[model samples]
Target: MKTVFSPLHAGHSGNVELIAGAIVPAFEKPSRAEFIRARVESEKLGPILPPEIHDLAAARKVHASDYIDFLPTVWPLWEASGRSGSAIPFTWPTRGLRGDVRPNGIDALLGFYSFDGGATFVKGTWDAIKSSYDVALTAAALVKAGEPSAFALCRPPGHHAGAAFMGGYCFINNAAVAAQWFRDHGAGRVSILDVDYHHGNGTQEIFYRRGDVQVLNLHGDPMTEYPFFLGHADERGEGDGEGFNDNYPMPFGTGWDAWNASLEDACTRLSAYAPDVVVVSLGVDTFEKDPISQFKLKTGDYPRIGRRIARLGLPTLFVMEGGYAVEEIGINAVGVLTGFEDR
Candidate 1:
């Protein structure tokens, strides 16, 4: 497997997120990708390549144009406003609020475009965001060009981001963009399997009304996890997408046994869907040592997850998502890829 990575991700550093009722350093950081890259090299997994330059054309298909426009403007607006710290949204237009209005002030625009406080921005954030998108698109291109599988080592992980809102350290939904890229490039059908600790709420909403792409997620239960509004078992697609979306929401402290059972069922359904290509939203935050997540998956179990996905026997793209256990991230994430190759 060829790995697509970008050093620009280092620019997205020094960010913060609101957790436990106070602001602190974000768990999603640049070292997360570096550690994974080091592991890939030590294991001789594959050659690591820099991302190819890509435009907003592919991302626009998965994200809202206004939201895409809002990204590059974040740093400039913050700098011009004389803000000294990383830009973070503290308010939101919630239920009964006027969601249709767009704010003109920097502070208001931040809140308007973000769903929570986690998607904060530093001066180099915009460049990093664009590079992350480029990384994902380039890896998708590799798979489209006949590579059996590729790993998109994206930073500032993108799963909680929705069509118009950013949150959970995500600015663009990289996996969703890659899935759509496959479809636009002549794939008859495509499926996304998000194995992150948190539900891929953005992915679910992006394809909720379309039947051509299938989205499945295995994560912590929304009732007790981050991004709690979506990921319910009953959130079956709304229109043409009905019955195409599935969620395996496990409770806290879920170990490999129960988790593997859910993975087995999800894979069974994915094989039945029979997509032309598969995109795995690979996240190792389910590792027992992940600080913010509660799953009990150990480093050794990652390969099993990879082997099971390999059973599908379709071209696959592994797009990085969440995984904050910096030191062990590479061992677990690459374990999945090595496992897939072993199969």
Candidate 2:
């Protein structure tokens, strides 16, 4: 497995969060990737390096030109609002409105690009997100090169960002970007397996009407999850994409026994489809003790999760996703990789 790294992630760190009704230290830290890399080294896991940018064509295959341009500039405009140093949005746009137009001002622009309150665009936010996208594209190239696995240690995880919007601390939808690249190059079919604690609403939205790319998510029930708008068991894909999408919304207090069953079912569907490539939106937020999540998965269960996925033996790319048990995130994430290696 090749690991994707980026120093630009360090510049994206800033605290502006709401927890327990108080703005406090940001749970989504840039150091998450840093620590993950440290763990990769200490474990003596495998080779690690930052991916060389594979040209913006692959990224443009998934994101819009306007949105891509807006990505790095949102913060500068937000900062130009004349508040303090950096700015965060308090309100967001909702459904029923046509989202065809891009708002130019910061306030309206925030609604245009982001969906929720968990994310903020500091001066460096776009730079960090662009760097993250580069890292993902670089890792995707490894998949094209026939590497069985490549870990893109991306921050401000991208599973929550769709083609036109961003949320849930994600800005570019890394897995979706990679899957799109896979299709653009030569893969006949691509599947995204998002196992974040919260639903990958953005990734799902991006490929909802597409047949060639299938999106499967095992997440907290939207009824009780962060991205409360989706993740229902009935949300099969629409149109030609019908039956291509799948969601397994496990309840809170769920453990490995139940989660693994859901994973098995997903794998079965993916294997039957015989996708040319598989991408894992690997998030460890379901850890039993995660401060913000409710799933009961222990750290040791991750390797088993890896082994189960490795059984598919398909070319896989693991993109970093949410996991706030910062202390154990690396072990758990890498555990999945090592398990795949053991197989």
Candidate number with greatest lDDT: 1
User: RMSDs, each prediction?
Assistant: 0.8, 1.7
Q: What's the true lDDT of residue 4 in model 1?
A: 94
The worst-scoring run of ten residues by lDDT in candidate 1 lies at 82-91
> Please, what's the RMSD in Å of model 1?
0.8
Clashing pairs in 2: none
Model 2 misplacement above 4 A: 18-22, 95-101
lDDT score at residue 319, model 2, on the 0-100 scale: 91
> lDDT tens digits, residues 115-165, model 1?
889999998999999999999999999999999999999997888888998
TM per candidate comes to 0.99, 0.95
- lDDT of predicted model 2: 0.84
lDDT, residue 316, candidate 1: 99
Q: Candidate 1: which pairs clash? A: none
| Clash totals, every prediction | 0, 0
